[model samples]
Structures are given as C-alpha cells and as structure tokens.
Target: MYLRTLYKYKKWLFWLVTIVIVIQGIIFLKQGAVATPFFNYGMYSEKIPYLDNYPVYKIYANGKLLQGNDFSIQGWDRIYVPLLKFEGKDTVNAEMIDIRNRLLYKLRLGSLDRKNAHFENPDFDDQDFYSWYRQYLSCVTGVSVNDLLIVKQDYQWNGSRLLPGDSLVIWPTIP
Candidate 1:
C-alpha cells in the first residue's frame, strides 16, 4: 500500500523538485550576471554574458578619496545599466533621471544633467544617501561640509579591469 502511494505521487514530487531547481538556478545565474535576463524572464532583452562592461563611480571630497562603504556604485552597475540599455529613451530612464536629479538638488551636488550618452554631472543624488554620507564624512574626516571639494569620476570596466574615463565636477570649493 505504501509503495503504491509513493509511486502514485512520484510525478508530483518530481515536478515540485524540478521547479525548485529551476528557480534556484535562475537566481544563481542572475547573481553571477548582475541584472541578467533568464529566458527573457526578468528582462526584456536577451541576457548578455559581458559582466565587466559596467562602469564604476568614484567619489572624492576635499582631494581625499571617500570610502566605498559609505556610497556604493553597485546600484548603477546592477540596475541602471541594464535599464538604460534596454529601455533606451523611454520613460523609465527619464523617471530615473528625475529621481536622481531630485536627490542631487537636495544634496547640493548640482543636477546630474544628461546630454546624449554622457552625463554632465554623473554625481549621485539621493537624500537619505546624503544624510549618511554627510555624517560619515564628518565623523571619518573631521572636515567641514562647506570646505569639501566633491567630485565624481567614472571608469569603464571590461569584465576584468577598469580603464580611465570621464570625470565630473560635483562640488567646487576654493582651497
């Protein structure tokens, strides 16, 4: 009787295990590829294997490099890169720009102002981001917020290494 029951439900068990494995595999692949598409499941376009084609943003204030823990460029590399590429000149990118601009204006970093494929400011703009960044800078560097000269520099990555690239002036303070 037990053997018969097991055999009867074996197909259901097999399907359940298969579904779980597929979901786990998708997650693992997504992590490895950043914002990658799976059978066009999570993305509109086919997944590309170039993981290192992302850009890295570096922040410097008062001629001193800021700590990466305080602000991360992962969001740009993970979320924005894929969207910008797939959506092109769609409303999604515009909305993202607007959100970024609002944050920049609040942080007094100036607007990110984009022109064509280039960003005029490239400087990040987020309020909660600013709150923590300001506090972190104050505590870590003991530098007054007004005296810091903040700037953002972007580097292109080629799956393995980063190359020299664009620089944006975020905060200009006289020395």
Candidate 2:
C-alpha cells in the first residue's frame, strides 16, 4: 500500500528532492551565508570560545533579591532580558545604522550621511530606564516596587564553583 502511494507521487517526490538538493548545494557553496528555510550548518560547526568572566545583573526589588532559582525560566527571562537589551542599546543602534547604510547602498540610494541623515533608532530612548524598569518589575512580580537596585557583578568559574568578583550598582544612584 505504501509502495503504491510512493509510486503514485514519484514524479512530485523527485522534483521536491531535486529542489531540496539544489538548495542544500547552494547553501554549502555559500559557506557562512545565512539562507533561511535551508540553513547553512557551517554556522554551528565552529567551537564556542571559553570566557574567563561572566557579567550578571543582580536585581533587587523593594530590598528583596530576586533569585532565578525561585522563578520559572520565562519569569527569569522577563526579569533580565530587558536589562540586557537596554544595556546593549548603543551597540544595537550602531548595527542598525550599518544595516540602513548597506540597504541604501544596495538600492542605489547612496551611503548614509552622518550629519544630515534622519535615521532614528528603532528602540525608544528612555532616559529614565530604571524608573520604567521598576514599574515593569512591579507588574511582572505582582508587587509594588518602591525601590529597585541593579548590581552588575562579574563572576569567574574556578572549576568547582562560580566566585563573585567586583560589583557595581548600576541603578538608583545618587545625583
């Protein structure tokens, strides 16, 4: 029964297999190129580099330290992902500018003008990010956040355990 069905769709199957093979060949030849639908496995073929230190944001809401162990994976993500994104806003802006310039150049619209270009960053510039973050945290944690403290701590792995090093309070600083 299966063989009869396979035989019936043999022509369609042949074309489908041929198209996939062609796409795979193109992806292989392109090397590091990002081809969606048919991905280049070369992207994951390289070994990830080892890092000596890892920076983590320790968030305290209303004098209580929020531990990842106490929350679900998604809950922890909601707590820290915005902080990571907000911290790298400048880097994101720079990449966005580069992308815009490349797109303009590709479409024969000339390069981006540093002084005159009206390019605005897609991410909203929140001068008082901590204030907003405090409110956001309140909503996420289901508690009123009167005080918020974000400590950027660098941790080093010493084979056995992670040792906390130099800490800096990044939020709620005195003027």
Q: Tell me the whole-model lDDT of each prediction, alpha carbons only.
A: 0.51, 0.78
What's the lDDT of the predicted structure labeled candidate 2? 0.78
Q: What is the lDDT of residue 6 in candidate 1?
A: 50
Best by lDDT: 2
* TM-score against truth, every candidate: 0.31, 0.69
| Native-referenced Cα lDDT, model 1 | 0.51
TM-score of decoy 2: 0.69
lDDT of 2 at 64: 93
Taking the tens digit of each residue's C-alpha lDDT, what string does model 2 give over 1-175?
5545654779677667677779888888877444578876565568977578889989999899999988899998999899998876752466667766776779877644453245553445544677788899999999999988888899998888899999998886757
- Count of backbone clashes, every candidate in sequence: 2, 0
Error of 1 at 3 (Å): 16
| Model 2 clash tally, residue pairs | 0
